[model samples]
Target: MKIERIEEYDERFEKDIIDQHGAYVINDETYAFQVLDRDTCRVTFSNRNDLNEAIEEYRFFGGHISCFVDQNGKILKEYDKVSFFDMKLEDIYVSQFYVSEEKIKRLLPYVKEFLIPVAKIDGKMVSLDGHTRMKIAQLKGISHVNCYYEEAGDYAKDFMEEAQQRGIFHVYDMPLLSKEEYEEKWHRFCDDFFEQRKAL
Candidate 1:
């Protein structure tokens, strides 16, 4: 993924109805807009400088912006309280890794194929580290679900710890592997994981 330095926040109005609000702002924006049918509002700033400035403003103001939007896309006078912890799947980055075809064939029958639970960080939605599961979810028209706000560094460490604890050293943290190595090993692990699951 392309990492750009953020500088300001750009605010724009949406023409959608707020159906169910999520727990937190998915990104570093003041308003976290969640609309009906699982659609979300994306804020586009002119540049990274402006984006960073906006983020800083939001952080200074208590790390959140809460408001209620009506069906006509109007923000109601009453402010809704939202926490930073209530992040969505869209906010996180997807690691570049390949899912094995064998795993897909094996898990296809047993897995629920909807809203695959990825990783969670302190109870908030984070990244879709599982490439195979994400692809499957998309193919099936299922929402990719996860918890929020985990630093990439911290996530790398946690992933390593979990793998080591579970004796899954073969599937090491993505950061530790070279891009090519990650692709090969991830595919192998995906196949083996589903194969074991099927055996049970």
Candidate 2:
């Protein structure tokens, strides 16, 4: 099935989401929306066709993204979050040293966008965020995740350089630490860097 993203919205569709409550009468039976930062208001499919034994309940909340199908189409109950990797493991660098087992377990069950970018200082790609997800991906034996280049801040170069100095060149290089160990080691190091920056 092809997913066509609606780039433009009509008046009623805009009013239904923006005006707090525009009633479901304005929808086209397959329209669904999840407003960001507005939990109370939800615009869903207007066509209530054959609910008897076909479908019982629809989730009131959506994931990070919103999906709406076309006429004769239906909402997808779940989505496959793809992690398309291009660069090899050797091409990527890790910014952090330790990963918390607790945090990894907590996040592994959820859908996440695994993004990486090139470091401005050294011209090498490093993970600014989603370090845990990267590690998890590595543990799962998947090579080459997604890359969103040039999105790193200036401090990212420093973090990557520090990780490089510590021999952490890839996600697999970083070791798993207990929550306490992670806080004491990784968090302290990050905190110290920010504090030094503040002093400067």
Name the regions of candidate 1 deviating beyond 4 angstroms: 1-90, 113-125, 144-200
Compared with the true structure, all predictions reach lDDT values of 0.38, 0.55
10 residues in a row with least lDDT, candidate 2: 52-61
TM-score of each: 0.28, 0.55
lDDT of 2 by residue, 1-200 (tens): 22222323445465334222122332233444443221121435545452211111122212222333333345443333323346765567877777888667655754344444444356666766667767877888777676644446678778887887998878888899997898899989989999999999
Cα displacement (angstroms), candidate 1, residue 47, comes to 60
Positional deviation of 122 in candidate 2, in angstroms? 1.6
Residues 1-200, candidate 1: write the lDDT tens digits.
Answer: 22222222223322221111221222443333332221222333333434444433333322223433444655443323332333233443343334455445444654442232234445433343444555555556554443323234433545444454654332122233444565577657657756776798
> Which candidate comes out best when scored by TM-score?
2
Worst 10 residues of 1 by lDDT: 15-24
